[model samples]
Target: MSTYSSNQEQFMYQTIIKWITDDRWMMDILRNVRSLSLPDSWVCAGFVRSKIWDQLHQIEPRTPLTDIDVVYYDATDLDKKTEKVWEQQLSRIQPELPWSVKNEARMHIVNGIAPYDSTVDAISYFPETATALGVRLDEQDQLILVAPCGLTDVFEMNIRVNPHFLQGRGDMETYTQRIQQKNWQHTWDRLTVVDS
Candidate 1:
């Protein structure tokens, strides 16, 4: 079964499209990330999450990002060391940005889960529903947003554990720790956390 129904999926896509298209900084960030030419790459997680939350809260979008997560799928080169190479390339492209490149192909070992089939697959298991979003600009500069968890929690300002991450006891522990560590409500006063 799909995580989101067709109509909900479409609405989420449209909302992301409109937001990214209307924001020049986001467009620039996407364009820069795209320039890396990584296979099946996308600027994901909090890169998109924080923006939506900021907008919803009527706060400035200028909040410092924890990291500009750049995720890609390259099965041929699963070496975790190679991720740093991509990170360096991204740094050269945007020297001032805090870029973090991750190869989803090998991340399963780090997370103690099965291998991810693609970047979106890895995103689907991210700890928070809101942080599972990803965005990329295609060759034609068309914006594509991948949200396997949908946009309900994000638009509603809720933080909930991903169903996929709930399967393992370790993952559940990690999820709980992540929520406490984030302390999102301290910043976004209206944020809601659903641990159950």
Candidate 2:
């Protein structure tokens, strides 16, 4: 089974409305993509967190959403020039939104990179691909939500999200061990332990 359900978006909408006011921001962030002719989706894994909350957080009330995860699946069969055009266009667009960049706690993707960062160059630092229910917009402007599609969302585009950066060393065995040893909520405890 997938991590999300396309039909369950309403559940996501209702659950996070108190904090995110999601649709409004989605429409705004996507305005430029719509102008340049790209298709995208404002998906929430936390939406899945909605039903699973009682078992995890011990309450079903609103959780402070971390970020607005948007994945744009463009269908333009992009050549290098076409990709560059869209990338530059999007770079000019991100700042217009109110999302925070501190550790990418505001808005980001799971597959693609920041518009100014190239896949060939940035991939060394992050990976890019389509996300679950992987779908993108066609040149005609339609939302195709499916799985194993063209590209995953840009979860790596998040600012300073290198899961291992704080560790002064290049070895991530400790970090990987941390993730393996803990739950998602406390995944960053090692960093916070330093701050405390």
Candidate 3:
């Protein structure tokens, strides 16, 4: 067991890397979710977003991918004509996944906690991997990112990371402008923890 504290290095060395390469576990999720569905109403926050951030910051060095962050593009898309759908979907797959389902937020807010404030949701703070974003796609290549999943109590939507959208605006202008004005160099200096 890990007593993850300020020792992020030790945590990554002992934990994160092992899970990333766990193909058996990963395939289990893929297979279980194969027959699963997407929320035509919500968007995802982690994997796709991480890819874009990685490309932009590759200027510094190649960043690895680990924790993904996701949110719905339009948060309020699901409401009517859904009964026990989320439970049905999640129940069918929960037994196969390593991570357990918790809250199903229409949008997982990234309120800029600290060091991670790289995006609206602070995705950049992840230690070993770049933050990511994902969304759901329809059969005709349309997006169903914010569809309501199971019952309200157990509603969990499935989403696909949208690399296509991330590739469009490479620089992420809105966030860059904010960081530039703040003088991140000085901010980092003031941080309790920082890179050399």
Candidate 4:
């Protein structure tokens, strides 16, 4: 259950949207992804999380993203090659940007879980609640945000394991390794990491 009320979630959603809108670079990335027109696609994970964390920390300049993660659901065409093709397309649009494209429909095979229902479903299963976020631009160029686990954790700078990870859908060792490797607290000093 979410600790935040619906109003709080809505407020945070609006806050995030406003932040992204103010960021020309982020808006451009969203625009580039929208051009692909992939079914149920969004730039997710650290791409969104890092932005919020950086904002919350009041970092002077934006933290450079290691890569822009683009995820879409296309059960009809689960070809992994399609992801690479999309990456190539995005690269042509912004060659300097590091882009990673993935078809969530086929990611289940890699994650050792039953097929995900949609891109949002796949996001909910991400290792950490803070990372289970996504955003995209709609036809009207309006920003849309999705956080299946809600916004409380991210807003509070809490890095807790997702419920799916706790339910045996994912393993602890992998989660632990990710937490250790990410060491997000080093970047966002206010963050509190909860492995268990």
- Candidate 1 local lDDT, 27-113, one digit each (tens): 998998888789999999998998888888888746678789999999999888899988887788778889889888988888787
Task: Show model 4 residue runs off by greater than 4 Å.
Answer: 1-5
Worst 10 residues of 4 by lDDT: 1-10
Score candidate 4 by TM-score against the native.
0.95
Q: Model 1: clashing residue pairs?
A: none
Any idea how many clashes model 1 has?
0
lDDT of 2 by residue, 1-196 (tens): 2334454543433343322333344434445445654433323233323223322244534444454333333333433354455555665787443231111211124323343122111212321121122222344544433322111122211112232222222235544464345344342222212110
**Which of candidates 3 and 4 reaches a greater lDDT?**
4
Q: Can you write out model 4's per-residue Cα lDDT over 1-196, one digit (the tens) per residue?
A: 2433578887898899999999999999999999999999999999999999999999969888899999999999988889999999999999999999999999989877788899998898888999999999999989988988889899999999998756637777878888999988888999998655
Q: What is the TM-score (0 to 1) of candidate 2?
A: 0.32
> Which candidate number would show the highest lDDT if scored against the true structure?
4
* Model 4 residue 155 lDDT score: 96
What C-alpha root-mean-square deviation, in Å, does candidate 2 show against the real structure? 11.4
Report the Cα lDDT for candidate 1: 0.84
Q: What Cα-based lDDT does every candidate model obtain?
A: 0.84, 0.33, 0.29, 0.90
Best by TM-score: 4
How much is the lDDT of residue 108 in candidate 3?
A: 29
TM per candidate? 0.91, 0.32, 0.27, 0.95
2 versus 3: better lDDT goes to: 2
